[model samples]
Target: MRARDLLTPFPTVTPGTSVIDAARLLADHDLPGLIVVDDEGLPASILPGTQVLRLAVPRYCQDDPALARVVDEAHADALLSSLAGRAVRDVLPGRPRELPVTDPDATALEMAALMARTHSPLVAVVDERRLLGAVTLKVLLDGLLAQ
Candidate 1:
Protein backbone atom coordinates (compact mmCIF):
# COMPACT_ATOMS: atom_id res chain seq x y z
CA MET A 1 0.00 0.00 0.00
CA ARG A 2 1.02 3.60 -0.49
CA ALA A 3 2.08 5.78 2.42
CA ARG A 4 -1.14 7.75 2.20
CA ASP A 5 -2.98 4.72 3.53
CA LEU A 6 -1.33 5.34 6.91
CA LEU A 7 -0.89 9.10 6.83
CA THR A 8 -2.26 11.35 9.55
CA PRO A 9 -3.08 15.01 9.10
CA PHE A 10 -1.77 17.42 11.72
CA PRO A 11 -2.21 21.12 12.34
CA THR A 12 0.17 23.41 10.47
CA VAL A 13 2.00 26.61 11.42
CA THR A 14 3.01 29.81 9.69
CA PRO A 15 6.56 31.08 9.42
CA GLY A 16 5.95 34.39 11.16
CA THR A 17 4.83 32.87 14.46
CA SER A 18 7.35 33.36 17.26
CA VAL A 19 9.42 30.45 18.43
CA ILE A 20 7.74 30.66 21.83
CA ASP A 21 4.31 30.09 20.31
CA ALA A 22 5.64 27.31 18.12
CA ALA A 23 7.00 25.56 21.18
CA ARG A 24 3.59 25.77 22.81
CA LEU A 25 1.95 24.29 19.72
CA LEU A 26 4.48 21.46 19.71
CA ALA A 27 3.85 20.79 23.36
CA ASP A 28 0.09 20.83 22.83
CA HIS A 29 0.36 18.38 19.97
CA ASP A 30 3.28 16.38 21.40
CA LEU A 31 5.12 16.76 18.11
CA PRO A 32 8.83 16.97 17.41
CA GLY A 33 8.38 19.31 14.45
CA LEU A 34 5.69 21.18 12.55
CA ILE A 35 5.02 21.43 8.86
CA VAL A 36 5.31 25.15 8.24
CA VAL A 37 2.99 26.56 5.62
CA ASP A 38 3.25 29.58 3.40
CA ASP A 39 0.55 32.14 2.66
CA GLU A 40 -0.74 30.00 -0.18
CA GLY A 41 -0.99 27.01 2.19
CA LEU A 42 1.96 25.17 0.75
CA PRO A 43 4.58 23.35 2.79
CA ALA A 44 7.48 25.67 3.44
CA SER A 45 9.74 24.28 6.14
CA ILE A 46 10.20 21.78 8.91
CA LEU A 47 11.12 23.27 12.27
CA PRO A 48 12.68 20.64 14.46
CA GLY A 49 13.36 20.48 18.22
CA THR A 50 17.14 20.56 17.86
CA GLN A 51 16.86 24.06 16.47
CA VAL A 52 15.23 25.16 19.70
CA LEU A 53 18.02 23.63 21.78
CA ARG A 54 20.74 25.48 19.87
CA LEU A 55 19.00 28.83 20.35
CA ALA A 56 18.77 28.31 24.10
CA VAL A 57 22.51 28.99 24.56
CA PRO A 58 23.23 32.16 26.51
CA ARG A 59 24.46 35.03 24.38
CA TYR A 60 27.29 35.78 26.78
CA CYS A 61 28.53 32.22 26.64
CA GLN A 62 27.92 32.07 22.90
CA ASP A 63 29.52 35.43 22.08
CA ASP A 64 31.99 36.61 24.72
CA PRO A 65 35.40 34.99 24.79
CA ALA A 66 35.89 35.69 28.47
CA LEU A 67 32.46 34.28 29.27
CA ALA A 68 32.99 31.39 26.91
CA ARG A 69 36.03 30.43 28.94
CA VAL A 70 33.92 30.35 32.13
CA VAL A 71 31.18 28.30 30.47
CA ASP A 72 33.33 25.20 30.91
CA GLU A 73 33.04 25.78 34.66
CA ALA A 74 29.37 26.77 34.75
CA HIS A 75 28.03 24.97 31.69
CA ALA A 76 24.73 23.63 32.98
CA ASP A 77 23.42 26.91 34.42
CA ALA A 78 24.51 28.88 31.37
CA LEU A 79 22.70 26.51 29.03
CA LEU A 80 19.52 26.53 31.10
CA SER A 81 19.50 30.31 31.34
CA SER A 82 19.97 30.64 27.60
CA LEU A 83 16.89 28.51 26.92
CA ALA A 84 14.62 30.34 29.33
CA GLY A 85 13.94 33.50 27.25
CA ARG A 86 14.70 32.47 23.70
CA ALA A 87 12.23 31.97 20.81
CA VAL A 88 12.09 28.94 18.52
CA ARG A 89 12.68 30.70 15.20
CA ASP A 90 15.95 32.06 16.60
CA VAL A 91 17.48 28.58 16.49
CA LEU A 92 15.90 26.61 13.64
CA PRO A 93 18.27 25.63 10.85
CA GLY A 94 17.75 26.71 7.27
CA ARG A 95 15.44 24.29 5.47
CA PRO A 96 17.24 21.17 4.46
CA ARG A 97 16.75 19.52 1.07
CA GLU A 98 13.41 17.79 1.33
CA LEU A 99 12.42 14.41 -0.02
CA PRO A 100 10.69 13.94 -3.34
CA VAL A 101 6.96 13.51 -2.76
CA THR A 102 4.53 11.36 -4.63
CA ASP A 103 0.84 10.75 -5.18
CA PRO A 104 -1.26 7.81 -3.99
CA ASP A 105 0.15 5.80 -6.86
CA ALA A 106 3.76 5.79 -5.61
CA THR A 107 5.24 2.48 -4.62
CA ALA A 108 7.05 1.66 -1.39
CA LEU A 109 10.38 1.45 -3.23
CA GLU A 110 9.92 4.99 -4.49
CA MET A 111 9.28 6.27 -0.98
CA ALA A 112 12.29 4.33 0.32
CA ALA A 113 14.60 5.87 -2.28
CA LEU A 114 13.53 9.39 -1.43
CA MET A 115 14.12 8.73 2.27
CA ALA A 116 17.49 7.17 1.60
CA ARG A 117 18.62 10.20 -0.35
CA THR A 118 17.37 12.84 2.06
CA HIS A 119 17.86 10.86 5.27
CA SER A 120 14.31 11.89 6.03
CA PRO A 121 12.42 9.78 8.53
CA LEU A 122 9.18 10.84 6.85
CA VAL A 123 8.09 11.73 3.36
CA ALA A 124 5.45 14.35 2.76
CA VAL A 125 2.68 12.66 0.80
CA VAL A 126 1.25 14.93 -1.86
CA ASP A 127 -1.05 14.67 -4.81
CA GLU A 128 -0.38 16.35 -8.14
CA ARG A 129 -1.56 19.63 -6.67
CA ARG A 130 -1.95 19.29 -2.92
CA LEU A 131 -0.40 17.86 0.20
CA LEU A 132 -2.13 15.12 2.17
CA GLY A 133 0.03 13.85 5.00
CA ALA A 134 3.39 12.36 5.85
CA VAL A 135 4.58 8.76 5.60
CA THR A 136 7.08 7.82 8.24
CA LEU A 137 9.59 4.99 8.45
CA LYS A 138 7.63 3.57 11.34
CA VAL A 139 4.54 3.38 9.14
CA LEU A 140 6.45 1.55 6.49
CA LEU A 141 7.95 -0.89 8.98
CA ASP A 142 4.63 -1.53 10.67
CA GLY A 143 2.91 -2.19 7.36
CA LEU A 144 5.63 -4.67 6.44
CA LEU A 145 5.42 -6.35 9.81
CA ALA A 146 1.66 -6.67 9.54
CA GLN A 147 2.12 -8.58 6.33
Candidate 2:
Protein backbone atom coordinates (compact mmCIF):
# COMPACT_ATOMS: atom_id res chain seq x y z
CA MET A 1 0.00 0.00 0.00
CA ARG A 2 1.06 3.58 -0.51
CA ALA A 3 1.92 6.13 2.17
CA ARG A 4 -1.28 7.98 1.39
CA ASP A 5 -3.31 4.91 2.28
CA LEU A 6 -1.79 4.94 5.75
CA LEU A 7 -2.10 8.66 6.26
CA THR A 8 -4.21 10.14 9.05
CA PRO A 9 -4.90 13.71 10.01
CA PHE A 10 -2.59 14.79 12.81
CA PRO A 11 -2.07 17.87 14.93
CA THR A 12 0.17 20.69 13.77
CA VAL A 13 1.63 23.80 15.33
CA THR A 14 3.26 26.91 13.98
CA PRO A 15 6.73 27.97 15.11
CA GLY A 16 5.30 30.70 17.31
CA THR A 17 3.00 28.42 19.29
CA SER A 18 3.68 28.53 23.02
CA VAL A 19 5.68 25.58 24.32
CA ILE A 20 3.24 25.00 27.21
CA ASP A 21 0.29 24.98 24.85
CA ALA A 22 2.05 22.50 22.59
CA ALA A 23 2.82 20.28 25.55
CA ARG A 24 -0.85 20.36 26.62
CA LEU A 25 -1.96 19.29 23.14
CA LEU A 26 0.57 16.46 23.11
CA ALA A 27 -0.60 15.23 26.50
CA ASP A 28 -4.33 15.60 25.81
CA HIS A 29 -4.15 13.71 22.54
CA ASP A 30 -1.40 11.34 23.60
CA LEU A 31 0.32 12.27 20.36
CA PRO A 32 3.88 11.12 19.85
CA GLY A 33 4.69 14.49 18.33
CA LEU A 34 3.36 17.41 16.35
CA ILE A 35 4.19 18.55 12.84
CA VAL A 36 5.52 22.10 12.71
CA VAL A 37 4.30 23.95 9.66
CA ASP A 38 5.93 26.85 7.91
CA ASP A 39 4.30 30.04 6.69
CA GLU A 40 3.11 28.27 3.54
CA GLY A 41 1.64 25.46 5.63
CA LEU A 42 4.39 23.10 4.52
CA PRO A 43 6.06 20.73 6.94
CA ALA A 44 9.13 22.35 8.49
CA SER A 45 10.00 20.14 11.46
CA ILE A 46 8.72 17.52 13.89
CA LEU A 47 8.41 18.30 17.61
CA PRO A 48 8.55 15.06 19.52
CA GLY A 49 6.64 15.00 22.84
CA THR A 50 9.84 13.96 24.56
CA GLN A 51 11.33 17.34 23.76
CA VAL A 52 8.50 19.07 25.58
CA LEU A 53 8.97 16.83 28.61
CA ARG A 54 12.67 17.56 28.60
CA LEU A 55 11.86 21.21 29.01
CA ALA A 56 9.34 20.58 31.79
CA VAL A 57 11.59 18.45 33.95
CA PRO A 58 14.55 19.76 35.90
CA ARG A 59 18.01 18.73 34.77
CA TYR A 60 18.79 17.07 38.08
CA CYS A 61 15.53 15.16 37.96
CA GLN A 62 16.29 13.98 34.46
CA ASP A 63 19.68 12.76 35.64
CA ASP A 64 18.16 10.81 38.48
CA PRO A 65 14.92 8.91 37.97
CA ALA A 66 14.37 8.91 41.73
CA LEU A 67 14.42 12.70 41.84
CA ALA A 68 11.73 12.81 39.17
CA ARG A 69 9.47 10.67 41.33
CA VAL A 70 9.82 13.09 44.21
CA VAL A 71 8.41 15.95 42.13
CA ASP A 72 4.69 16.23 42.83
CA GLU A 73 2.22 17.08 40.12
CA ALA A 74 1.98 20.65 41.41
CA HIS A 75 5.75 21.00 41.39
CA ALA A 76 5.85 19.48 37.97
CA ASP A 77 3.45 22.17 36.81
CA ALA A 78 5.66 24.75 38.46
CA LEU A 79 8.64 23.39 36.58
CA LEU A 80 6.96 24.41 33.32
CA SER A 81 6.86 28.06 34.44
CA SER A 82 10.12 28.66 32.61
CA LEU A 83 8.43 27.71 29.34
CA ALA A 84 5.51 30.11 29.88
CA GLY A 85 6.40 32.55 27.15
CA ARG A 86 8.75 30.32 25.17
CA ALA A 87 7.80 29.40 21.63
CA VAL A 88 7.97 25.93 20.17
CA ARG A 89 11.04 26.91 18.18
CA ASP A 90 12.83 27.84 21.38
CA VAL A 91 12.58 24.27 22.66
CA LEU A 92 14.31 22.83 19.64
CA PRO A 93 17.93 22.00 20.26
CA GLY A 94 20.34 23.62 17.83
CA ARG A 95 19.33 23.28 14.18
CA PRO A 96 16.09 21.44 13.62
CA ARG A 97 16.43 18.11 11.85
CA GLU A 98 15.06 17.91 8.33
CA LEU A 99 11.39 16.90 8.33
CA PRO A 100 10.75 13.38 7.08
CA VAL A 101 8.67 14.07 4.01
CA THR A 102 7.38 11.42 1.60
CA ASP A 103 5.45 11.32 -1.62
CA PRO A 104 1.87 10.09 -1.38
CA ASP A 105 2.65 7.36 -3.88
CA ALA A 106 5.57 5.98 -1.89
CA THR A 107 5.13 2.46 -0.50
CA ALA A 108 4.48 1.92 3.20
CA LEU A 109 7.81 0.17 3.52
CA GLU A 110 9.55 3.17 2.03
CA MET A 111 7.81 5.44 4.51
CA ALA A 112 8.81 3.14 7.38
CA ALA A 113 12.44 3.17 6.31
CA LEU A 114 12.50 6.94 6.08
CA MET A 115 11.01 7.31 9.55
CA ALA A 116 13.52 4.79 10.94
CA ARG A 117 16.45 6.53 9.33
CA THR A 118 15.35 9.88 10.60
CA HIS A 119 14.39 8.59 14.05
CA SER A 120 11.04 10.31 13.66
CA PRO A 121 7.69 9.05 14.92
CA LEU A 122 5.75 10.39 11.96
CA VAL A 123 6.27 11.17 8.26
CA ALA A 124 4.58 13.99 6.45
CA VAL A 125 3.03 12.92 3.15
CA VAL A 126 3.23 15.77 0.72
CA ASP A 127 2.40 16.32 -2.91
CA GLU A 128 4.73 18.92 -4.32
CA ARG A 129 4.73 21.61 -1.63
CA ARG A 130 1.37 20.81 -0.06
CA LEU A 131 1.10 18.54 2.95
CA LEU A 132 -1.65 15.90 2.64
CA GLY A 133 -1.39 14.34 6.06
CA ALA A 134 0.90 12.23 8.23
CA VAL A 135 1.73 8.52 8.52
CA THR A 136 2.25 7.81 12.18
CA LEU A 137 4.29 4.96 13.67
CA LYS A 138 1.17 3.23 15.01
CA VAL A 139 -0.56 3.39 11.64
CA LEU A 140 2.55 2.15 9.85
CA LEU A 141 2.93 -0.78 12.24
CA ASP A 142 -0.71 -1.72 11.85
CA GLY A 143 -0.40 -1.61 8.08
CA LEU A 144 2.70 -3.80 8.10
CA LEU A 145 1.26 -6.31 10.55
CA ALA A 146 -1.92 -6.60 8.51
CA GLN A 147 -0.02 -7.40 5.32
TM-score of 2: 0.88
* TM-scores, each model vs. reference: 0.65, 0.88
Top candidate on TM-score is 2
Predicted candidate 1, C-alpha RMSD? 4.8
Off by over 4 Å in 2: 69-73
Scanning candidate 1 in windows of ten residues, the lowest lDDT window is: 80-89
The candidate that wins on lDDT is: 2
How far residue 3's Cα lies from its native spot in candidate 2, in Å, is: 0.6
Candidate 1 residue-wise lDDT, 2-65, digit = tens: 7778677756677676666776686787765566766876667655544454466556656775
Q: Pairing residues by index, what is the TM-score of model 1?
A: 0.65
RMSD (Å) per prediction: 4.8, 1.9
What is candidate 2's local distance difference test score?
Answer: 0.85
At residue 48, candidate 1 shows an lDDT of 52
> Relative to the unseen true structure, what is the C-alpha lDDT of residue 86 in candidate 2, on a scale of 0 to 100?
92
